[model samples]
Target: MKNNRGLLIVLSGPSGVGKDTILNSLLEKSQNIKLSVSATTRSPRAGEVDGDDYFFLTEKEFKTLVNDGGMLEYAEYNGNYYGTPKKAVEESRALGQDVILEIEVNGAMQIKEKSEDALFIFIMPPSRQELMRRLVDRKTEDEATINARLEVAEYEMSRAGEYDYVVVNEKLDKAVEDIQSIIDAAKCSAKRAKKFIDEVLNNA
Candidate 1:
């Protein structure tokens, strides 16, 4: 008997913390939530489909959206632009669907500034050594890149206190369950149910 608007859940974590793996698992298990697809200037990698993985755009297009104020939040990283499209998020929320935004810490902070009610969740690894192992296992980046990522991860982890919830991603299933529970609990929050409560009191 929930009558409130949908929840905006922002999930962020340091690099190599398995955020993507956890998010993919959570989406596969949950049907009530939708992923907020981001628009990026980076080229689509192999097996990455446009509109599914990302709305790949040219640099010009990305700058145009930014200038037109069409993006909810955007950031430039490694000379590429990435942003959340305002229309998709607004449309999904209007239909009472919870929107899950898997973004970076900086992007999460931007969302917080714009939408204070949004739930922010930060994922953490079991240990720094494990995180390093995970990064090396990927074999995607060079040593220098990995070192840079590690440095950035340390800084991102420092800001974990800014988030509303911190879920340790030691076990995949447990982490997914923890986030699902957080979403359920957030939906039942007093702020979300205020309208119903006020109506009941008025009628009484």
Candidate 2:
């Protein structure tokens, strides 16, 4: 059994940067890393599964959990509440499973304030033009909304320097590979490896 504790990976990126697609691919390639399912008050979108994608909750229920300290981080956006369940993440880490949080900048900042050990990664698009193109291609948002998102993306990208690593999502496969390598390297970091070293020395 590994004596080292699992890592908390907080991933954040601008909208339309393919964060979801990259995360899905990362999970498919890696084992022992679990997605931290967030709880939200918003109605499920098309094909979004409750409990799997998010723990869909009513506004009252979501607020109750937040008030009770059940959430590690919570944020309100577009009149909907979204948060990470504290217990789920704690339990997963206790079992030595790394938890990846695909969250927004606000939520990621909250996590950073709480857990200094957590690994923060910011995803970037190839260019501003490419980001705009991807947002328009989605067809889910109107022109006004797309423009709003682009403005927000520019601001979010400005915060990329705050993260531990910045990955450019030029190629899906390469991005996944890059993040996987980062995770592996993080596991071997001196801070995490020291726990195993201490255990061995004490046992000796």
Candidate 3:
């Protein structure tokens, strides 16, 4: 009874977690879902496409969009603005495509405040040590940056209680399976099935 509208899924996790990897696998496995690309005011790096990588915007354009309530959620960092475009999300959902918003905890919380129909999912690392190990193994950042990420991760994990589901990312395959199952169950929820139920009763 999903009807003609798709579910809005908000996925949030701390930095250094394998959220991008997990999401890539999930997208490869499913055709009915699509990632919600974010809009940003930052300049694109090498080989980055304008619309594909991000909807690149000037600062004035970004501010105008935000002022007009065109953004689902937004944040400013390092003098650049990043946000989810509400129109694109609504258009996708209207086409019965499940749109997954991979954002930070604060953005997820903003979605919660604005949209009650969204399902919030948090990705949890196996443990602090394992998370740190993964971050260290990347070797892309200095020790200080890695330590800062760990601290931020702790804060993000503290807010996991607010999410509807928390998938521990110990095993990639298992975590993806769990999320698939969760989405399947959410689709069949009483609220989602109400339309079908009404039609059946009316026919009877």
Candidate 4:
């Protein structure tokens, strides 16, 4: 039999790098991969349901979880606490579901510190100019906000070298295929496949 444990993928990138779009496409084209849902301390917006939109928790409750090691990663964003819950991710992986945590650089680093087996991947923009074009094209934020995001993007990209793999989002479909290929190749790596191979050899 093949290895039964699922891959834990930590995906991180700059704010304007089309991570959401790439993830949407990747999920559609992949199987046995589950996107992780994070918990948040902020009040839910209209039509946003707990557990679906996010696991809404009080600040005290969130800190309690962090202290108990129930959080894989956590950070304060705009005064609201957001964190990836550890238990659900572990459960999904146990059932052979590859779980992807689409978090920021700081959170990704936290996961890395906690789990060395996690596969870390960073999504990159083709270039700085292209990245700026994307942020402007969206027209969803003011000029000041976009500039602030670009500054953060620069800092985030500096950390790309820390990741195990990097995918450049020049074309959506191609990026998805490349990420899928990375996952497929990782599954066959000697480190991951040796146990199953040994079992087969022993049986034979």
Candidate 5:
């Protein structure tokens, strides 16, 4: 019955799987989609700003936000907490902008529970061997972190079956095109285009 409901797009994959890279590219090519900046207890890295990369917060502040039901979803990893703020997402939705969240498997599942109609896309590396190779190639994490992430990747990959769409990142352009098609198709869904349907019926 809603005339202009927004699309909530959730993208999830393991670390070093190029989810962030592909998301960045998609944002560049998108016209009305906005990325949801997450709030994290982790300190800002070398060049990350307070509200740009993430909404950096202290443990206490993050706990406060969680307690007050301010976050859409939250989880702790590597001794730090990360969550999506509810306000920005709602604001963007009100403006009819597509809101994209680059979160983890757990968070994606949470969103699915809350928003059954949300678009869920799981990005996959070409293969496990390629995943490991990319992890090493990035050179961003220490060996211990990389290994830990790989193990987590195994678990996350297992959950890909739960997603609405699985995009294999074998080739950059192909993957992007696949994701773009999914989004475009979602926009034309009957639920989203009810007004158009009604108009045609009334005219007839």
Candidate 6:
């Protein structure tokens, strides 16, 4: 139903991982899901729009939100602060739109602690060697940064077991289908669809 509550989906992976790629591709296929854009203190690059890409703010503004408890979860990366805005996410969910967040490992942990009902997903490549190749192929990072990302990926991969679901991006189409199946299964869970069940039983 249109009035049904939404599901909060937390998606996380390493820096060079395909979280964004998979999410964006999923968005193209699914019309009902809303992508959660984070707020950041870092300046946007050329062609990046505010609210569309990220909610760009100053360091002081970001710190203000942090101190005021406006952020759901936040962390500093490379001297820039990034966080999810709690209010926007809640409002979107209340409107029955599935909110999918692309977050870091630490932020995902925070979400798990706060939103226990949230569905957490961990995305991974087929292997570390393949992951490195994908990162190199991006041509967006230097050798030093690439190595550092690989190191972080190893540690992040260790935390994959903590998530509710693990979808390896061995092949994009198959992974997307797997993710869709997970969402469908979650929607049909007894805990979430109790109202429909009650109505059906009453009618019978």
CA lDDT of every candidate: 0.90, 0.90, 0.92, 0.92, 0.88, 0.88
Clash total of candidate 2 = 0
Which segments of candidate 1 are over 4 A away from where they belong? Answer: 42-50, 57-61
Error of 3 at 148 (Å): 0.4
Please tell me which predicted candidate would have the highest TM-score against the true structure.
Answer: 3
User: Model 3, 74-135: lDDT tens per residue?
Assistant: 99999899999999999999999999999999999988988978999999999999999999
- List clashing residue pairs in candidate 2: none
For model 6, which pairs clash?
none
Q: State every prediction's TM-score relative to the real structure.
A: 0.89, 0.88, 0.95, 0.94, 0.85, 0.87
The predicted structure with the larger lDDT, 2 or 6, is 2
Tens digit per residue, CA lDDT, model 5, 1-204: 344656789999988778877888889999878999899999889989988889999999999988887888999989999999888888988898889999899998877777757899999998999999999998888899988999999999999999999999988888888998999899888877778788888889
Enumerate residue pairs that collide in model 1.
Answer: none
| Local accuracy of candidate 2 as per-residue lDDT tens digits, 58-148 | 9999999988989889998899998999888989988889999998888888888888689999999999999999999889999999999
lDDT of 4 by residue, 1-204 (tens): 788889999999998898999898888877899999999999999999888879999999999999999999999989999999999899999999999989999999988899968999999999999999999999999999999999999999999999999999999889899999998888888888888889999999
Q: What is the lDDT of residue 59 in candidate 6?
A: 94
TM-score, ranked from best to worst? 3, 4, 1, 2, 6, 5
Worst 10 residues of 6 by lDDT: 1-10
Model 3 TM-score is 0.95
Candidate 2 vs candidate 4, TM-score winner: 4
Q: Is candidate 5 or candidate 6 better by TM-score?
A: 6
